[model samples]
Target: MTLSEQIPSDARIAVVTGASSGIGEATARQLATQGYHVVVGARRVDRLEKLASEIGGTALQLDVTDEDSVAAFTAVVPRVSVLINNAGGAKGLAPVIDADLDDWRWMWETNVLGTLRVTKALLPKLIESGDALVVTITSVAAFEAYDNGSGYTSAKHAQAVLHRTLRGELLGQPVRLTEIAPGAVETEFSLVRFDGDESKADAVYRGITPLVAKDIAEVVGFVASRPSHVNLDQIIIKPRDQAGPGRFSRK
Candidate 1:
């Protein structure tokens, strides 16, 4: 049977990348509850399999940085009504002078090209779905720059721009693009950023209550559930305690 034929007639397919944990995992669970057959992809097969089992969805091993992996993952997906480009993260935090070229390369490859690869591979499937939504989880850094965060901020900026540009390029097409830029949603973000330094990661959110992964996932669910005509171009979500990049209200 063809890809479209493999799916239930009433079921809508939603693809979530970076779905091993945090926002991607939350979003996968959320979409599954909404009656979409969620196809979750990530590098962690164990976690992905557990999540897929819990949600009754399919789990596929996907490394967005690998072209063959992306191609293989997308090939089996059949159809995609919603594609969540959430496979991105930050690396080392350092000043330009002391910057790690390896860190920069990783950030660019994962955040920018990773999204491009997955999105490009599934574009045809997205369009063929008749009504599709592409939600890219960006960061506050996408629009603002800060000290010692040039690598991550630059990568996010490029990812956001790529998502935004798709809006116009697909104007009359059957797809809708939404860019979700979140401020301080506490997850493995700081832990990953600080290289598993628990104390440093804890310090990042010590002062204020940060938004959790579920907060952003709910917004994604909202965006995905909108009528086909309603295209939410961009949404910036931050906790009330957060004002901007470095501006936070610490109690």
Candidate 2:
């Protein structure tokens, strides 16, 4: 059967981008448990299929940085009541003067434009569903900047602004927008940032306990389960040991 046909006509559909791992994966699982038919998307088809199998959801190959991929992925989604904009990352920790243009490009493309493309494509569906929620997984970087983190922080700021802008633009619309900004989450995030340097990645959480993927996922679930009239605008989550960016309370 076709993908759109597979989803029940009355099902409350939730589309999760970057669902292969970390926060995205956990959020997809959480939404599935809440009885939403979670349509999981990511660049990794194998992992997406495996996750879909476990959660009884649909898997679609997606690369948010690619316009064609976003178009094709959105084309098959029959309906969307929830959209988790979780496909984003950081690359390199270089100062502005020593920055790699390629890394900056990647951060902007993935974190900023990526969110824009997917959100814009599915907005009509979200609005048409009549009680839609858009949860964007931005970072604490969205709020503050630190040394050697300009590229990521800047992109996050832009992404957060983009999300916030919709709040006013979509005012009176059925769609609700929530931005979840997390701090010190231990996942593949650091590994990717450090370019497979396990030691560097490991050091990021050495002195303090960090937030895990499930923590953010549960919050998404909570927001999703809220009554349609309720709109939880913004949530900033951090491990107890973290005070802010680079202000970790180390043991």
Q: Who wins the lDDT comparison? A: 2
- Candidate 2's error at 168, in angstroms? 0.2
Task: Flag regions of model 2 displaced more than 4 Å.
Answer: none
Candidate 1: segments with Cα more than 4 A from true spot: 1-7
- lDDT per model, in order? 0.93, 0.97
The Cα error of candidate 2 at residue 53, in Å, is 0.1
Clashes of 2: 0
Model 2 poorest ten-residue lDDT run = 1-10
Q: TM-score of every model?
A: 0.97, 0.99
Error of 2 at 119 (Å): 0.5
lDDT of 2 at 22: 98
lDDT of 2 by residue, 1-251 (tens): 88778988889899999999999999999999999999999999999999999999999999999999999999999889999999999999999999999999999999999999999999999999999999999999999999999999999999999999999999999999999999999999999999999999999999999999999999999999999999999999999999999999999
Best by TM-score: 2
- Report the C-alpha lDDT of model 1 over 196-223, residue by residue, as the tens digit: 9999889888889999999999999999
Task: Look at candidate 2 and give me any clashing residue pairs.
Answer: none
